[model samples]
Target: MSEIVIRTASARQGDIARRAEAMGVDDVFISDLVETFYARVQANETLGPVFEAAIGDEWTPHLHTMKQFWSSIALNAGTYGGRPIPAHHKHLDKIKSEHFSIWLALFAQTLHDIAPSPEAAAFFLERAERIGENFQSILFK
Candidate 1:
């Protein structure tokens, strides 16, 4: 029974990857999205300071990790293995609940600017929203 469930889950993830590819999502796209979005984040007055405090002057590693994270989330590539909740929790003193909304807005704008298609934008936005919600639940609790 567990085997059946695992197989079914794997098949579902495969279908999602195929659908994402049909909409023009790939590793390059994920990399571009992460780069563009982080650039926006760094430029924002509100999010910039918080992120700077958390990441300091080293952004390359964070950007790479983010690319892996998005790849795992959107394509089920299973490349990311970081603990995001604890990572966020480490900066709890600086992170505010309102920051999630700002982050989401920036993410949405980035998707609008560079996503290959509307479907692809929606695909990423849906996942981003869910991730934000989950983080809020855990971090705020």
Candidate 2:
């Protein structure tokens, strides 16, 4: 039974890989990465409350928006249209260097956890780090 279950999971993963190949990335993979990463952020002691307060009951919509954002970034799909700067402006008062560091670390962990390969993870991390830096500079400057 365990072996069968493992094979089933493996087969599902193969499907994800094939789908991801279509877009140069598996959309499901990106979605899972975002979902897992935010779950960590929500559970994180420092980041959780800040996000919870900012997000409140809007997590569903927020997650959808985020997925779109990542899809746009990773696949050049043009899926997201929102301005990230204004969206993050509300948290400017609460965010700090340390918070950005924590955010980057969590993001790195997420990439590590779900990325298809180390190179793939690094690609995502590079973009994430740049984004984080941009946000920090704009918010703190």
Candidate 3:
């Protein structure tokens, strides 16, 4: 499969080859990712409460948004069109940098658990790091 894999030029510049490859996963699309990811996130000691509080019983919509988000990210489907910044803005005062870090950690761990793939899993974590850092910057600002 490595021959079919393509190395990303730079993660900072929208490296998405890994995502593209992962998109071929028919059984596990954005919905699966979100469903599986959130389950692990809820069980995670560090990230669960924060997400639960922010999400409450509204995890359904959030899950849908996540499905769209990852779909846009991996499949280039552009189905994700929500403003997380504003959503985060609401309860961000309760969040800390560690929240994002732990979230990423758990996300990476979850990805590893679901399907073992060097390139795809690494790309997911890389994107998480970039996006999490962006959130942290905004939070601290």
Best candidate according to lDDT: 1
User: 1-141 in candidate 3: lDDT tens per residue?
Assistant: 356766564663344544465544332644666798899888888778888888889988888788788767766666877888778988876688778777887788777876446666766678888898898888778
For model 2, how does the per-residue alpha-carbon lDDT over 98-134 read when each residue is reduced to its tens digit?
A: 8999999999988887788876788789999999999
> Would you estimate the TM-scores of all the predictions?
0.90, 0.82, 0.78
Candidate ranking (lDDT, best to worst): 1, 2, 3
Candidate 2: Cα lDDT at 86: 87
14-125 per-residue lDDT for model 1 (tens digits): 8988998899999999999999999999999999999999999889999999999999988988999999999999999999999999999999999999999999999999
By lDDT, the better pick of 2 and 3 is 2
What CA RMSD would you report for each candidate?
A: 3.2, 11.4, 6.8
lDDT of each: 0.95, 0.83, 0.73
Model 3, backbone clash pairs (residues 3+ apart or across chains), number: 0
* Candidate 1 TM-score over all chains jointly: 0.90
